[model samples]
Target: MAVERNIKCVVAYDGTKYQGWQRLKNSDHTIQGKIEHVLSKMTNEKIEVMGSGRTDAGVHARWQVFNFHTRCQKSTKNMMDYMNQYLPEDIGVCQVEDVDLRFHSRFHAKKKTYIYRIWIGEYPPVFERKYVHVVTETLHLQKMKEAALLFIGEHDFQGFCSRKVKKSTVRKINHVQLKQEGHELTISVTGNGFLYNMVRIMVGTLIDIGKGTLTKETITEALDTKDRSKAGERAPAKGLILHDVSY
Candidate 1:
């Protein structure tokens, strides 16, 4: 029997055209599906790759990680080249390596960092409209920063999540950093794990707080009451990016 080797890969993709990261049964319009198609062609086997996590539709990823087991004899470098050659131009393979057979990308991930970019420029972001959320209102960074502090550390993030959780809603947020440069405002968050739409909802709440529509007390209310309605609107998916995943 040919030995099956675990192959790990890092990929970056513009998720504008794809549905999401996870593969769907009826549809092939996903990042995972596209890569799997190319990989299967190369290996001559039906391959299923395990992703570190899913990114929602219209959400981009700069350093998404996934792993799969394959019996193909190609070197890691050749596999990477083959994937890039066949995969859509929107998706790019950054690295490929042979890893331990037991290595599972999703379970092995220890931390993930996500970044949401907002443009507060006077004019619309004509050059980068697809990549950022453009906001015309003045956003008070100080207020947003103060409100952001409330999210750090462990908490039952049920209120921040948009979906009902069958599992525990508790998640640990390591840090929330906000930076502004000219017309750009970036909200970067590092967390152990996140509930569905948690980061986007948090960003939306922060934006509302900055605009004086919501107060810092709103975060406390969400944490204390576990009411999703207490949180702000979920931010648009275009602004969100999976920045990195660390094992």
Candidate 2:
């Protein structure tokens, strides 16, 4: 029997040109699809890469992890080099290593961190327009900080999720840290797991608090009622990035 080598890689992508991470029959312009295409071409065989989770279209990723099994005997360094050479400029393999066959990127991940960047200055971010979401509205940073605390701890985040979901909505958030550097408001969330659009909705609700549109109590109401309409608007995907993932 031929041996199957399991390889894991850390990838960084702009996500501006691709449809998303997951491969779909409806569209072939996905991050996963693109990676598979390059790797398959080099290995002269079909390859399927599995990611930790699917990020929405236009969402950037700093360090996304994926795994795939191939019979090719190339060294890890060679594979990584070939990947960077063949993949598009927007997508790059930062690191690659061989792992046990049992290593599953999605199931083995312990925590994931996502950062949402909001540009608050009057002058729109010309260079970072595709990377950050520009909002000119005046924001009360102190009030937003207080509202962000509501997302900590475990809860049924039904209201925070916008996508139609069949799985349980219960997830635990370790912390939501907000920082301001110059005109950029960076919201970072570290969680055990997140439902679809959970972090974005939470950030949206915090923006509401900054604008004095929603009180801190609104978050409690949304969680208790389990109604999506009660939650704040979902932020744009362009502002969100998969900052990191830990196993």
Candidate 3:
């Protein structure tokens, strides 16, 4: 009988160039496609990896979790080293562990945290260009904080989600906070799950509030109305990052 095994891995990637996490027939620049390519080459067998969630194109990840089943008897270290050799420089496998066959990275995740970075100065530092969003206007941190507070708790975030989402828009937000370090502003949000473009939309709404484009009351009204147009625009994907996921 063939031995079955499962492996869980923590992955990080600079998603500046990739099309996203999922694989597409004609796209060769997806994170999943790159990882699966390296794994297939190393094991000489095709394998499908299950990611904790799908991140949109140009969205970076700091602690994305994924799992795959394998029949190889190699040690985790050996596999990790071999995979690194074949994987691109932008992607890194932080850790790997042997797991039971029943482990599913996506379904078992309890919470996910995402961070959106904005540079609130005239220009961003050259070194941080790929990771941060540059905003020329001065932001009102107090108003942004007030808007973020309204996002906490369960709500039907239909207004914040993009039209492409096929699933229900109801989601529970555990925490939402806005902080600033010099010219760098960070919006961190933790939740059970998020709808398509939800995080970006939230960030945009906060930004609109800070810029005096939208008021805090508008957030509650948008949520209550479930009107997509009432919310602010979706922020750029380059500013969003998957900070972590807890299982």
Pick the TM-score winner: 1
Candidate 1 has an lDDT of 0.95
lDDT (10s digit) by residue, model 1, range 61-109:
9999999999998999999999999999999999999999999999999
CA RMSD for every model?
Answer: 0.7, 1.1, 1.1
**Cα lDDT computed for each candidate against the true fold:** 0.95, 0.91, 0.91
- Judged by whole-model lDDT over C-alpha atoms, candidate 2 comes out at 0.91
The residue-by-residue lDDT of candidate 3 on 1-247, one tens digit each, is 4588899999999999999999999999999999999887776679899999999999999999999988877899998998788889999999999998999999999999999999988765688889988888878999889788899999999988887466778899999988899889999999999888999999998888999989998899889998889999889999999999998
Candidate 3 displacement at residue 127 in angstroms: 0.9
Regions of model 1 farther than 4 Å from truth: none
Better of 1 and 2 by TM-score: 1
Question: lDDT by residue for model 2 over 1-247, one digit each (tens)?
Answer: 4689999999999988888898989897899999999999988889999899988888889999999999999999999999999888999999999999999999999999999999998898988899898888899999999988988999999899987678889999998999999989999999998888888999999888888888888898999998888888888889999999999
Per-candidate count of clashing residue pairs (backbone under 3 Å): 0, 0, 0
Measured with C-alpha atoms, the lDDT of residue 56 in candidate 3 is 96
* C-alpha positional error of residue 53 in candidate 3 after TM-score superposition, expressed in Å: 0.5
Least accurate stretch of 10 residues (summed lDDT) in model 1? Answer: 121-130
Q: After TM-score superposition, what is the CA distance of residue 231 in candidate 1 from its true location, in Å?
A: 0.1
List the lowest-lDDT window of 10 residues for candidate 2. Answer: 161-170
Which regions of candidate 2 fall more than 4 Å away from where they truly are?
A: none
Superior candidate under lDDT, 1 versus 2:
1
lDDT of 3: 0.91
